[model samples]
Target: MTPEQVMNIAYQGMRVTLLLGGPLLITALATGLLVSLFQAATQINEMTLSFIPKILAVFAVLVLTGPWLLKLITNYTIELFSNIPAMIT
Candidate 1:
């Protein structure tokens, strides 16, 4: 394949990867920030306090977005597979 085609494929793969991972990562980050703020305000100072909430938030996002995420990855895989012959040429 041409360099342009290879780059395009790599770009698409990264885009899909980010799309797939962005939600969970963002959820965890937001959750952690909120938990930290709460801990600070309450003077809790418990390092492990944020873990559960972060996990729960990420899990909730994953659960809520699971179907859409699945469909997205499935579609991307299908499209990539379908384009394989063209890519080969």
Candidate 2:
């Protein structure tokens, strides 16, 4: 394959990865920030308190977005595999 084709494939793979992971990561980040602010305000410096909320929030996010995430990854994988013959020499 040409360099351009390789770059295109890599870029698409990265885009798919980001799309698949972005929601969970963003949910975790937001949950962590909120938990931190709450801890600061309440002076509840317990480690488990912070950990539990983030875990719950991430789980909720996964539950809510699981179907869409699965569909996205499935579509990407199908597309990539379908294009393999074209990508080959």
Candidate 3:
């Protein structure tokens, strides 16, 4: 494969990875921020306080977006596999 083809594949892989992970990461970040704010307001300095909320938020996002995420990855895999023969020669 040419350098350009390799780069394209790598770029696509990264894009897909980001797309798949972005939601969970963002959800965690938002949940953490909200929990921190709540802790500050209530004077609760427990580090573990944020953990459960972040986990629950991320889990909720994963559950809500699971089907779309699955379809996205499946489509990308199918496309990549379909292009393998072309990439080989």
Clashes of 2: 0
Which of candidates 1 and 3 reaches a greater lDDT?
A: 3
lDDT by residue (tens digit), candidate 2, 3-84: 9999998998999899989999999899989999999999999888878888899999999999999999899999999989
Candidate 3 similarity to native, TM-score: 0.95
Candidates in order, TM-scores: namely 0.95, 0.94, 0.95
Per-residue lDDT of model 3, residues 1-89, tens digit only? 89999999999999999999999999999999999999989999999999999989999999999999999999999999999999999
Q: Point out the worst 10-residue segment of candidate 1 by lDDT.
A: 39-48
Candidate 3 structure lDDT: 0.95
Runs with alpha carbons beyond 4 Å of true place in candidate 2? none
For model 3, the stretches where C-alpha displacement exceeds 4 angstroms are none
Candidate 2: lDDT of 33? 92
lDDT score for residue 78 of model 1? 99
Q: What is the lDDT of residue 89 in candidate 3?
A: 95
For every candidate in turn, the CA RMSD to the true structure comes to 0.8, 0.9, 0.8
Sort order, TM-score high to low = 3, 1, 2
